[model samples]
Target: MTRLPASCSFTQALVNVINVLSGIGLLTTPYAVKEGGWMSLTLLIIFGVVACYTDILLKRCLESSPGLHTYPDIGQAAFGVAGRFIVAVTLYAELYAACVEYVIIMSDNTSTIFPNTSIHIGGIYLNAHQIFSIIGILIVLPTVWLRDLIGGVGASILVVLCLLWVGAVDQVGFHRAGTTLNLANLPIYVGIYSFFYAGHKVIPDIYSSMKEPSLFPLVLILSFIFCWFICTGAAISGFLIFGDSIESQKHANKICSLQIAVCTVVIITISKYALTLTPIASGLEELVPSKWSRSYGVSILIRTALTISTLVVAMTVPFFAFLMALAGSLLTMLITIIFPCACYLSILGGKLTNLQMGVCIFIAIVGFLIACDGTYSALIR
Candidate 1:
């Protein structure tokens, strides 16, 4: 029954949504296109349309009950306590996976800048990627202790502009015409595209924060439209510039290393890593008894532990594209597509027409299939 203060303006809400949707995902779009070929850009468009529809579905669910504020609140309203737990876990896991992606990005880009760098500490050797990853974790640790959010919106957009500069102003011309399609790898593209539109878990919070919640739908629409173009532009331009050879996320970094693309990615990842992990850290703190959790030392301990864990995962499974695909297919699919429809139908079934019910069921089915397909594809790769 908790409610957020109504403070966000329409423009603020739009910017917030765009920021969340256009994270490290933008940098990976070309790599995703390379994975499944140029024809797979259709998946990006398809996912954008469907994910936007589900955002509306989530809004409808929130409107059905005034008590709903957070995503878990919608879940509790839809199917009670178990529903809340499911939504909360899925959302947190997705955020944590995103943190891992951030670390991997920073590490990859750092290595890109200093290709032969390495370090040795206590007789244990660390290569450039591992050393830089540890440094990234340390750099972001202090940000986790702060309460305010300093996100990476500008750096992501800067990356798109950098791509353009690399292709046009620089000599990296858009001459490589890629293949029309490749069915075998399309599932990987699905997961990555699914990752592109995964801001749904925060929609309820954004709606609650709005000065006029009714304008929330407009915010969602505009946000999706804007981000769609950004993702599409990056994909089309990156693929054309780099072609099929741009097979991994690191290659996206390689696209414009001279344009300080790696530097931008490093900055974006560093800025976003703590902001992304803070919610999960706060959630864990809430689990401890109030007196202990309120202690400054305890809070720092929890946040640092979380950051270190993500660094370990980043170092262990360092394949950025495959990991992102796995997270998108397994986590983003559930959060952005399946659960929203399920909750909407559960909460508002009585008011819906038969067509509405059928459509929800159909969308849920398609989301589930994509999740399974993409998860398997990502894992095997």
Candidate 2:
């Protein structure tokens, strides 16, 4: 592919990177801490390092070949059509899972705002959570019809500030004497931490849009470090405030300023479903003939079908944190960690020094273990 003109400045690209890294994962930090003990917080740092490294690997893969412009493109360059297919399917699955998580979170918070919400249709009964999940998706479904829009990153900052205010000014002291380590629950937190930096999928676009493409590595480093601090602060503050009783979506139940914070995230969650699913819908449209792909009716049908699938999945498995863990482990680990290293080694292995090859192999092994252990733990718990 011909090189596109670069127009995005350093600051613009930095913000875009942060926006991709920050998402519903912000709400689960405390729960993750509660699950694996305080020491498990280190996993966030470890995963951040691994994510940044793998992202650089992806950038190297892109730089090695001018034809590569996306994650699937990297896969194809490294292997063949099969590699592209696998990467595309995994990326789409991860995006779809994220949409389901958004529906679950929106429903979870919406029910908190109106606790008694419920409905009856014929012989079927729907509780507040179920009713709200349907409403949330219906509200979000139309946004997919409109193509161009951007997402937000301020939610991460808002959540951190809220956690601080509630703990410092509101008198929720940091007095919890949490365990130093709980090896039994370590896998769960590993998966949660992985989800925090699952932004590598979009790095190619960010790379191509950069006014200074060579500085992409610097941007990746800064974004990951920034996100790591946000996650750490939220984890410590949230655990200090809520302690052992802190479960997934725990912030939604807070009656103080955190309630406002939760509502803000809820709005973001509702708004993000369309942004998440649009790519998947477009990919499906591409599978059809060109004539049908350009038809508005066909486009709407694809978008509606994807939205309805997410709704069904969200309603079936309503556990927010668990669903996140499952997605992060099964899909995100591959997209963010395993596949990047694999592709880099495959595409550019001839140029790598011994140390570089060893490092890539080491990181890939660690990523695979984390994916397996985390996936099993998420399923069992």
Candidate 3:
């Protein structure tokens, strides 16, 4: 059995969980909740329960497979190369698409935060979006190539403070904007709810990093509780803060754009860029032959190419809402609800009780239905 140094404490584990799970996904919660009206709350709770349940299931998966270092490893162990392919394609594609959207979102907010700016250098003018995009690339490039964690208690503390600031900022917006409480929007936002709570991809990494891996269940539970509170706070406060005026801000309040840029949006885009790119990069590394894996020049070239490709997409068809909705309903539903339950059943080899079987089928069905409608809704808009 191979064991990495158990350097992460429970507190560090908790903060890391919060940081990973809470990413830019929290930024969309308020607007999502507002979209489905009060009906969204009940859906959010339902999705939260499902998310927590599957998290435990995935943990059970790790316990069953000792040598698995990544989620694709788990998939391969469960169902061979096809399983691994499904995970790699779905997981990496989801993360890749998500990172691209963040690029657009970052640039969008950057323009708003620093709008109408034109800098002249060598008699050439640069737009604010261009300036910000270049800054984003420069800031993210080196970080993406480093293997050490950019996410930790240190970054997570900032995340928590920023979230609290968002809540407080929204509260002030509520008082100033005088948003009326209305719960009459259509209630088919289960996709968004599932997206908000989906954090299964990070579980295996966190589980491996722990001093006492057995205590991961506790961390998972506690982290879920912390995340749930912040999400609910953001959603409820934002409902009253932006209410009917959500269309103007789009993100849900006066400071939404600013918060999105400074808090976790760009940081997440930068930090997770490498994280999301890992599976693909690993594949590329393999193609380059074993001896070249340690070549710094090759690694930098790969990272730079990946970053520029994502930037290209971001600049092209930058449909922010569509991307989030797609990720939430289509991609997140699979990782959080469908795949875990499927893998669990496969591992048990049909030895489940009637209740166990029923629960699994039900959750899968719920996720499927939500993905369908959510995709449709996103496409139409």
Candidate 4:
């Protein structure tokens, strides 16, 4: 692909990255804050800082070659066709998992708002959660195939409003409970933090969109500073209100009319269905023959199959929090953190200084360890 036109201004690119970085994942951060108390808040800041640097490393790592539009292309350039295939598969797997989680979250929130919602077909009873996921798939089916992000700004606004509204309501009903946090939940908290900072998958896109791509570091720092304050406030405020009683999902707790807030979020999140699905669809399209890649029938079939498979997984697995944490541990650890460092080492070889090399090794080791512990905790709990 030739160099695309840089139509978006730097400010637009900054806001775009911010929107991608903060998604539905922020909704669960209250659980993390409640789990580790002040400790988790500190970790959130640390993670924010580390994320800024580590994600910049991804951009630098991609600098080893030009015209590398996607991770698979970079992988192929760095390694071989097999490496390319593996990277593509892993990226798509992560994306598909995310879409499934979205469906589950949307449906779960929908169910909470309407307790008695159910349907009976052929003498079988289905609750609101089950029905709404299917409904969600149908509603989102068409949007995913479209390649427009025109609704992105409106979606971001709704998400911010939902966060503030939920926090406001939780605070209004706030009552002090004896301070409590369990050490056992540290791994999960780390997982949540890792997941919350996950916008690395799109760094290449964000970088390419900027008019002054060389100044991406400035954008990274500024956006992260903004991210830390916003996320910290949201997390800590919710924790202060609910204390240790906060569940893995505060939205589902039916706290202080949270159901209504969740309803607003669910309505807003519908706009995001297409945004999340586009990457996965593009990944699928790459697997098809070039001649058939743009066939509308084939596109519909591919998307239909993708949607059904995701819905099936969502319905089968009710552990929303654990799954998100697991994705964070496994996908975020590798794709966002570990692999970038490893790739830098591989591409640059011994040209990097000892200090630079040591930093890469350190990040890889620490990320792997945290991911292992977090994945284990998510699985067990």
Candidate 5:
């Protein structure tokens, strides 16, 4: 076997953690907090801890099973074919949901930038949704086909850009509204915070890439601390600047002078995320080999499909609150809450503590209910 690179450090591993979490969700953190309040911060802390603990557990499992290559392999080693199937299903579902959400966000933002230019298809005029979807597919195809790709550095660059954008927005928002945080909004804040901190599944992939897998626990602790601090700072600053009046602002119109800065950051950040998700859609093709055997062709097709579907939904749907809620409450829960513990217990074997089992079942149950509730709410409202 080829030896792993000695230069790989914990910081590099942490970069992977940052890369995975620094997707479109970062942009939505402020919106989620606006609804949840300070409770969002509390949720971040709680979920962050759970995420870290789960990471440690995953690292342990990876260490114990030397031959386990992918996550599905680990599942198989732990719980036979049934376990593999469960993990695969959950992983696919999570990725599918993530892709859908990304497409939706991109379409919405694009429409905001270009309100005119409609394409007439069937009996209806093609709107921003159709346009953006086509655009999204066109953009995502190329990046998906390359094997052994390393976009972590690119993602880091985007993260820096996003930070700068947040700084600019915070400055303008703060100047206009002053530096007061509304304590009454804690619950909404916690819910939103949870949304941002929900990228735990990527931890093992990060750990495996590290020079020393054993240090992942420490890496996770420090990384999450930094991420939480940054998120909290951004959230407080954004809310202080825009308050609850953000939606009323004209599309592509920055709410304050700093909004121009925010938009610049948003465009770069979104581009990076769109690029990152391309690989996920490509991976899906592996499951359906008959339809997607050609990497280049499938990648292009998936991206195109996603982009178009997202743009259509965005143009037709005036609001994204329901979609975001569904993504957060259901898909996020599957990846963050349910899968981790389930994989851990299966790998470890034997019996789990009442507390451990309880938490696992609770997350699954709650996630299912939330998904159902959100779906129903979306249909009704």
Candidate 6:
């Protein structure tokens, strides 16, 4: 029953896109490339295009179905129970993925603060597992306690600050000689880079918040263009400055002085993203109620549980590259491929021309293949 304000403008809508896309992915891009190589960059461009196509399709669906609010709503309208299930699965997957990613980032940061304190048990050394768990709890509790959109914005601002800190460090390395791009490294880096730039799932929210939804396409186009340029620059800058030393950049060990500063910034950014994910988890919990049904206590308990779980994973695994890849694969499929094409098909009601349907189908298929490839690679690795 909560109604959005009518006063929200097109600029505000664009800002939302910026906020959602500007997260740990930006920081992780360099590391992802370390794993996959320069092919990551090509994938980044490809995914960016896919993301935009999906965004437009999602916007079109929203305009066509005025009553459809959330992603789930659009799914339901398009494919009935099956669609609803797909959306439900997608949303929860995203929530859990976000949680895991955030926790891992946080734990990594914590390791920097307490380097010698490896594992703690009952007055004995535990293991990396225990340390991760502890770090996760610490980060989750504080974040869960401040669960709200406003809090999310605060978290995002922290991320922005971290990016700024990285910028400063990059400046320090500016005087250092740059490296040449290895043409052989393009594929993997492109893929990883695309994942970093991808952020189209929330387009409907952006448009809905706008005073003029009609202007949304233009706004999205411009905003994504900006994001693309920024990401490309960041990738080139990090690669040129650090070269094969990019892996070391993950721990920020190469620049020890900037380590704490960079990690703190990254953690803050990711924490904000985790905060944004809480609502999705809460919504999922609503689908199956237990003794805690309709109880305010249940809400608190569920939120707390999710936060703690996320923190534990973050602390323990601390595999930033893996989590980013997983998130990229799953979310890219849902948002960039499936949802948009489904929206178009549903809205058109099979009445579209061959060319129109062909385009939608082609995009959907391409997205599906990329997602599948990414997911397969992630799991086996």
Winner by TM-score between candidate 5 and candidate 3: 3
Best by lDDT: 1
Model-by-model lDDT, in order? 0.84, 0.83, 0.68, 0.72, 0.57, 0.60
Q: Write the per-residue lDDT of candidate 4 for residues 113-209, one digit (tens) a residue.
A: 6768999999998988889888888878877666565334344345445556655653464445433556778888788888878777777777766
- What TM-score, to 2 decimals, does candidate 6 have? 0.82
lDDT of 3 by residue, 1-381 (tens): 112246888887787777677765665666766576665666666777788899887777777767876677778878989998898778777777767766765666666666787799999887876677667777777876765545432333354455456556644444333223334323235555667776777677777788888888889888887778777766666556556465522462233455543545566667666666655665666678668888978877886788888888776666665567777878888888888888877776467888997898888888777777777767666
User: For each predicted model, how many residue pairs clash, with residues at least 3 apart or on different chains?
Assistant: 0, 0, 0, 0, 20, 29
Model 6 lDDT per residue over 108-220, tens place = 55455555666545888855445745655664565564445432334434433444455565564432433334544333343455555556545565577788777877887
In the range 1-381, model 5's lDDT, one tens digit per residue, is: 012244568777777676566555555555555655544456667778876776666676787777864666667877889987877676656555555665555555665667686887778777775676567655654444343344343433343344456557444424343223455443333334555666654555566668777677788887788777666665555555566664411211232233343354345435454544554555566666675576566666765565556445545553444555555655566666666667777766455687876776676566556455544544454
| lDDT for each residue of candidate 2 in 1-381, tens digit (9 for 90 to 100) | 112237988988898888889877867878888788888888888888888889989999999988888999999998899999999999999998989888887888777777887788998999988898888887888787776557778766887888788888876767675788888877777788789898877888889788899888899999998988888898888788878777665454542235777667666775566777877888898899987889999989888988898899889998888888888888999999899999999999999999999999998898899899889988998
Between 5 and 6, whose TM-score is larger? 6
Tell me which residue pairs clash in candidate 1: none
Q: Residue-wise lDDT of candidate 1 within 1-381, one digit each (tens)?
A: 122347988888888888788888877888877777777888877888898899889888888877877899899998899999999999999999999998888887777677799887899999988988998888888888776665757878788888888788878788776677888787777888889898887788888899998888788888888888888888888877887677575765575465377777877876777778888988898999988988989889998899899999999999888888999999999999899999998999999999999999999999999899889988998
* Candidate 4, residue 128: lDDT: 87
Candidate 3, overall lDDT? 0.68
On the 0 to 100 scale, the lDDT of residue 305 in model 2 is 88
CA lDDT for candidate 2:
0.83
TM-score of each candidate? 0.96, 0.95, 0.85, 0.90, 0.75, 0.82
What lDDT score is found at residue 137 in candidate 3?
70
Q: Poorest 10 consecutive residues of model 5 by lDDT?
A: 248-257
Candidate 4 vs candidate 5, lDDT winner = 4
Supply candidate 6's per-residue lDDT for 20: 64
lDDT of 4: 0.72
